[model samples]
Target: MRILASLQVRLPPSRLFAPTCPTRLKSFKPLFTSPNSDLPLDGDDDPDMTDPVKLAFARAEAYKRQKLQAQSQKLEASLSGNGGSNAALENPSSSANQGSRASQVSAPKGKPPEAEIIVGDPTKFENIRRRGEEPEKDDGETEAYRPKVKTWGVFPRPMNISKTYGGGKVIRPGDILETKEDKEAKEQRSRELVTAYKSKMGLDVDPKLIAECQKSLKDGNELMDRGRLNQALPFFEKVMKDMVFESELHGRAALQWSICLDSLQRSSEAKVMYKKLQNHPNPDVNTKARHFTFSFEAMEFMKVKSSYLSRTTGYEMYFDSFVDNKEAYTSAKTETKEAGETQILPYVVFLVSPLFVILLIAVRKSFML
Candidate 1:
């Protein structure tokens, strides 16, 4: 028993509170060792210990440290007024505030962009004269000097009325001064009247032919009123050739024929017909035909005049030279007045003559007794 106890003491304590073997324990060391150990803990300290994730983290930390150092150097330089590059670097807090303000400015709620205004020199566009600038004079063209005439008094000088009428000195209020147009119109009318008279005596047109021509002219006029110029042209042209020039129907047919020719673009033929109609014996026909000879633009002006005159004055006279025959127009009024006077005279005579005859009979009976 003594020998077995000694051998057990000599043998190492049971592996409960101590390692099994010193050499084995040293061989199977922990992954993390003492802090003072020379072996690298991170993979960056040892180039041979390559770990992708750890190497990336180590590189990022180094880059961040370098960037901070550079930013601090820049800030110090700006504060010292040595570097003109980075003004914001001198005050980072204010720069951050300005950046936020810029972001807000870019984000407009719902407003349109402002309109850009452009200012330029007006003198570059046009030649403008200044107030104090002198006007340029024309070369070799001096203004003509006119002598002022003397005036005796403020009242106007009297015109010699006798000098105008062969020194007769007779002034008439109702006398009308004839214009060139009026004189020409009167001469044309006289010539037309003479031609009409000669035509009536020379041409022995049958009454039946005149009646048929008048009927044709009336039908043509009705077609023209309905805007059927094409259909009316043939009828008007036929009547214009067959009708006697002295007849009133001839003037009407000639005027309608010229109007159709104008509408059809036969301007040359229309001009000839209008020239002939200008000297028509009928006043109404001559005036209407003369208006057709005017320029198209002038005719439009006359149309406005005619409308105004027709409204204001119950008569439709376009030209100032055209005059209506007042004697013919007043014939009916004169006849009515004469008829009334004759009727009164007849009643007066019937009443007085009986009295006269009775007195005469009484005188004769006294003489016989």
Candidate 2:
């Protein structure tokens, strides 16, 4: 019994000390699987997860984007070239830009502007060059709309002719009519045309008036060149009267009139005119007038001196009355100097006679001694 009990205890100890089989940890599986998942059937196999459709779609989209990018780069290179065209290259049309991007990307290269017909009607090509209009893309369709250009013409009608239910004659350019009434009407029309363009013709200088004034001025200058002051004065005066407000003409007329007056021996009137012109608006006229006044006054003063000298001497004057001379006083001065030389001859005779008497007394004393 002791042996049996020892065996039983040993047996229990052995059983307790015996090695046990380790249970393998259950393999963990994620609820969401990868594309390459390979699961078995009946939840006992891995799933086969390969998405060929999605891969094909992704590759196709990448290729399309790459092609578009390449096309855009080519267009950019063309536009950056030196010979690049400027035919609305930077198109401002919003409508054209909002259309299909493919159409915009496929737009053709434009030609140079110098090669285009810019002078003709753009509407014939179904184009309008005005601003604020929509632009169209080349979609292989003819344009259906274009703006029209208009030109206006002149349609002149007769003036001052009362209209009636009767027929009238038509007048044309360079038409010849053999009637006095027609000539009068033609002249009237010419006058009307002149009146219409009168302002543009320059009021102070009409063609005919300028011709007349120029002729008169030319004739007056010719006469003046010939030293005919009297004839020149009248022509210049007529010019002044024709154009009264012309200060140059007025001054010239006044100067010529004074010149003629002086030539006619009318010193008082010449002096009066010159003094009046001293306050003239033109500086040249005033200076000329002042010189003339001084000259006249000098002549008058010299005349008074000559008259005094002639009266005091009680001799016939050397100068004549009819001489309209400006240098007359200078000649009178030479004559007065000659007269003074003659008065010195009387003093010379008296001195010589006294010397002779002294010589006679000296000779008698010497002979008596």
Candidate 3:
């Protein structure tokens, strides 16, 4: 009651002379509001009056603004020692009010944005190379599918590839970087097919070898005809390796192997096998091997045997195709390095110039001494 009396009695004399009417009390405005607030003064003048939700929002906002203004005045009064001493107070709410005043962003002007239709190919923005949706047979997959690969912790582990993604194969380069071992394994497997196969030349002295070779050859031939070069090549190779080199059957196996190799784009390996056929005991095999290896005579020979031989399309055969690019590339690289080494002017300028200058200095000093 004393505080209320003090507040009322503290009113200025100018405001005491003013008439205290019921209408004035009903339409009373705050002495001050937050500078940033755009709160509606009159309910009827509010633009959001049409929308009940927006009208409620505006009224709530106005109420909040009035409440904040009252609080700010209380805070000022406390600071000015009119209220209890709160000089050490954090005044977090006062700071927040200041922040709110500072954070007032200007309302955006003009019309609201409309959706625009994109022109031209939508595929230009797409990188979707997957042909079909990935088969999601996760139930069939093992619970823990750790790859059979050795990886250092310091180096990225192959298993770190996130399994969180939808089904699609992730190509990790760390899994495929073994150039030497992979090549050795591939070569070993290819050679193993040749040694392990039997009966390919047909009617071997050993019955078991004969059966194996014949089966291998048949399987290989069938696979080759069906466009399975990789599967077929092994059978032909096994048969060729099992049979005696001098035998006509062996030469036939070589011919088939070479033909298959040509189809498989392994013409270099095929040429090596074709070259060995030059030492074949059978005269027909010898001539055909030479014809296959010798590009000059192959066209004319191909013309004569075009009816049957024309079946293998894009079949390439060259005597020099027997020689791989490795040897030639190494030689050329060596020659270039040697040529570069012989031209030492740049090296002399960079390395020997200081030495030469030092030598001349020493000579001049020696003569002066």
- Best by the TM-score measure: 1
Give the distance in Å from residue 328's predicted Cα in candidate 3 to where it truly belongs. 55
TM-score for candidate 1, residues paired by index: 0.27
lDDT of 1 at 334: 92
Which sections of candidate 2 miss by over 4 Å?
1-207, 300-369
C-alpha local distance difference test of each model: 0.64, 0.59, 0.64
lDDT (Cα, tens digit) per residue for candidate 3, span 118-144: 478978846432445453433534544
TM-score of each: 0.27, 0.26, 0.25
Q: How does candidate 1 score on lDDT?
A: 0.64
Ranking by lDDT: 3, 1, 2
**Candidate 1 lDDT, tens digit per residue, 26-88?**
111222235743222332243343545655565455445554544455554554577735656
Q: RMSD for each model, in Å, please? A: 29.7, 26.7, 29.7
User: Order of all candidates by TM-score, from best down to worst?
Assistant: 1, 2, 3
Residue runs of model 3 more than 4 Å from their true location after superposition: 1-204, 296-369
Q: What are the clashing pairs of model 3?
A: 198-212, 198-213, 199-210, 199-213, 199-214, 200-213, 200-214
Q: Residue 151 in model 2: shift from native, Å?
A: 70
